[model samples]
Target: MPEMLMEVEEEDDVVPNGRVLITGATGLLGRAVYKEFKDNNWHVLGTSYSRLRPRLEILNLLDSSAVNGLVQDFKPHVIVHCAAERRPDIVENQPDSAAMLNVGASENLAKVAAAVGAFLIYISSDYVFDGTNPPYKTDSVPNPLNLYGKTKLEGERVVLQNNDGAAVLRVPVLYGDVEKIEESAVTIMFDKVQHSNKSANMDHWQQRFPTYVKDVASVCLQMAEKKLQDPSLKGIFHWSGNEQMTKYEIACAMADAFNLPCSHLRPITDEPVGATPRPWNPQLDCSRLEALGIGQRTPFRAGIRESLWPFLVEKKWQQTIFH
Candidate 1:
């Protein structure tokens, strides 16, 4: 099957002169970031640990020497660290691996960033919160409940401690059409509905702040460029869509937008019925990103509509669902 072409908004800004290094370029979010910078005509260098077919520099982030070598070679002015073990359940099961990738690799990247004097933008998660608050602010103290969140939070600390000029943007659920479906809840749900006639039975009780992948990447690139030009604009910022939505709401919205049946939905609680601890609420207040001139352009429904088109045409929806 031919790869689905992505529809991105054209921006007139020329890619800056300095090189930009993006880790995890194979992943959905990372790939979006790569496209954003590449479109601007910036000299883009990317890294991938497993999927090397996409033309990214093959490098394991855990390899400190290799990371150092890449830094020396590329000499990027901006380093967007998007690589991490992001599976919450898997991270809880295997913390050591998660720690190695999320915490240790991040520290290594920070060291390289400091050595090369590069502006580092680390992608963080709203899961850093313990779900006690409704809308988390950038200044909110993080109390992670799961290993994945803990690891990412540690990564955030590593970037901040290592480089005072670094910017850490904490985002929530990211929804978009991408090659991989493993890490995207929105894609997973949409696939289930489109192929298996199964719908996500999300608890209307649990709510979250979701951002479009393209929007998130755009914000990250803008922030990185701004930070490169002005050293004083360095700190942690919260980046999320403007609204708070439950999983059920999102699923229904997808179904409605795509003309899919929504009857398969089953209501489940925010808490795990048998095992695992689920963060009931992971909503973030993105006023900080807004103030920095980075915010959501399309509404949730419109974004979902745009994302669903590729799935409908590619007929790959069935491939995305399990059972």
Candidate 2:
């Protein structure tokens, strides 16, 4: 924990439009969410467990007392739950640990937020739906193919059950300004594209809408603001990038957009063999959130370029080509 967080400022001492608590504040999506809320002049206090930072409150969500104490002390008006065991393969390998965070921790956070009379927004995934269907709606039945999706779906259920005014924002694969290329599932492919001499096989069987984290974070801010004005803005909602592409297509776009090499990349047209099963094309129907006038979708090419440019420049890997 940082010494700044130990100072313990009284909730009433600060006056802002609203106060928001973001979990997993050091992760990809959480960082964006923290920035979005803070830029909007909201009183934002982000939490981190493993990746501790100066501003973030080091919190272990699995600890019930710590969770309650933080929420009670902060007294935030909104809580954005972004922390979870998100990796599908890893979740499959450790279902029990995943459940403790994705399911157990989520339920606890939702309950705590409700007890504090705060509006909670639970970040969910499109993987909750099986790929047999196209564009699943907010109310669509979830048939997760693997343990990760199932755990997220269960988290959604517990959150909604615990708080009537809580919302579940289901999004698809995400990419953003990453601390490392491997931080994002989408940008993780850059390794293959960057290694000009190394041949790699990319998955082209499944369709994915790679959404931007900054856009999702903006939507979360909008939802929080709207919820404050209208308390009835609750329930499951979907927000995803409209541009559809596969991993192979994404790598191709990265090469084109960033002037990276792709000759060594091979596209696998069939479902790629993996330890975990993923949906073929579980595109989310974002109309529910769009209807409420809350959403943003960045084009894939432009978004990826913006996300990776800084990292590329920092590594001095094709600095001349970028400018």
Candidate 3:
């Protein structure tokens, strides 16, 4: 808790007047956004559908009427849309439901924002790419490979179509702690180490640009403030950490950060082995965001250290400790 407080203080120094409305506030990124805003004295209002309790308001984004009602009632100056069907396998299994939530709900929010003249900051993904390119720029055409990516892409388009003054931020793989890291790419590898006492056959070939969850939240708030100040800064932008590395490299970094045995991690080639297709390359070029003076603050090792500390403290391999 003390460490979390210190981190909050550091974030507060960057942004003042943090009043915000965050969707998916129960998730890792959402929680981080909430804290970032709250620490900065921003009157934050959050929404959540799952049983997971949020610090502020909780509403189901899938419910259209509910979303509309909340937006109208809250009259938030900024809306950070973080809620979505993020799982690739589940999204593939139920594309329609994913569309309903990811696309439909987002459009509803956009409409509400327009009615109230609120600034919108929609969180997007790097999965929108097909993985053929090493590092995708903001101008690159999106070629999604899966239902999740397609749905998120549609959501982005919906927001843009609905609002002329909206900011859609495409971020890469985001990692942080609020609950256990059961499904995250980084946590899955940690699970392998915990049970097998050996690293899973590492797919060293697959490259991904991982963004720290807190940094992502910080950028979101900063972008929201920028949009509020200058309405013309409207369009799609790429936001990610400074460095890019393969899954094996990330695993090694996490292991080294936590003082764990890295020998257990073994390198493997890029080969598909499951029903879901993974992009071999999904690194994003964040120069667009950097030009806006919103660069990643935490280095890979430090971010890994911050994320791994809770698991080490709990003596349990959990992805998040707060939620």
Candidate 4:
């Protein structure tokens, strides 16, 4: 299968330009993307349905009229769609709510984005592929195992169908400067282990690429800048870290990072607790992303060092800058 990537001209950091509207501002990736664009000199407007913060507007995505109205008011040159019903359990139990928010909302946003003639960037997932695939490429056929993946795939279709110029970015498990521990998956284990001090079991068989949200944001800004200049750069693009490790390995790394009890960390090889059938290996081939001039990937250890929550507990923010 042929991979799809739109390599646009690179820009200088001393100057950042354009206007970006980010949905789901309260979410991990959304928060990072908002900061990324801002740091790059783009005027960014972020939205959250529940939480209201400085520079963040409240907009109900389920309400098309409200979304469209906001789009008209803001008139952003780029619309980054990060809002979605992401939890697998939630999507499984509440299919209608999932479809309405994940699928329907994206459809509406695509229409509004097109109306404003803005470049639409939809954040997708690696869940679209089954566990059988080790290294999923942009051209890989989607074989979603869960409702969340199905809904996201549907959202991607709606986005691309509505606006051909829209860019679909598929990422893996993410970690960021989290307001809450739940914001980052790896941190979830860290939280559990730190508090428990007893033991933690992680899936050793299942492999994942825990991409850094800041890195995701950085590459996204690059895509947005290129999209703003080149309209032809439209299609499904895969972006993730080169680092590949299982959940067990991730937990161990976090344990060391937080100075938690590493000995308590155990691998679940026989049966993953409450484990749902998922793509065991969804390692993304980022050569396409690299060809676009984005080559360096944040190492797992280094990414954890730059992320937020850990710093609050230990003040390690001075360790590094955004990659």
Candidate closest to the true structure, highest lDDT: 2
> For candidate 3, lDDT tens digit of each residue in 1-323?
99999999998776657457899888878888888877767778988887467356768787788888988888888899988889899999988888998999999999998888888888898989998975888889899988888898999999999998888899877788747766356655665554436447777776777788899888887887777778887878888776777777888777777766778778887575775887778778888888888755689888877776766643543446554
Please give the lDDT score for candidate 4. Answer: 0.81
For candidate 1, the TM-score is 0.88
For candidate 4, the TM-score is: 0.88
What's model 3's lDDT at 85?
A: 84
| True-vs-predicted CA distance for residue 76, candidate 4, Å | 1.2
Residues 1-323 of candidate 1 have per-residue lDDT tens digits of 13322222223244365699999998878988999898877899989988885568999998999999999888999999999888787898998989999999998898899898998989999889989876788888899987788999999998899887888888888887666554587666776555535445666766766678899888877887777677887888888877677777777777788777778876675565654565788778778778877665568888878776776743465556654
Our model 2 lands, by Cα RMSD against the true structure, at 5.7
Q: Considering every candidate listed, which one attains the maximal TM-score?
A: 2
Per-residue lDDT of 1-323 in model 4, one digit per residue for the tens? 12222222232434348778999988988989998898778888999987778868989999989998989998999999998888888788899999999899999999889888999989999999886856878988889988889999999999989987788998888887877777666666665555446777667887888888988998888888787777877788888877778878887777666665677777888645565567778777776778878534788887775673453443354355442
Instruction: Check candidate 3 and list the clashing pairs.
Output: 18-42, 19-42, 19-43, 178-320, 179-320, 180-319, 180-320, 181-319
Off by over 4 Å in 4: 1-16, 195-197, 258-261, 271-274, 308-323
User: Which pairs clash (backbone N, Cα, C closer than 3 Å) in model 1?
Assistant: 15-40, 15-42
Clashing pairs in 4: 131-279, 131-280
Return whichever of 2 and 3 wins on lDDT: 2
Task: Answer with 2 or 4, whichever has the higher TM-score.
Answer: 2
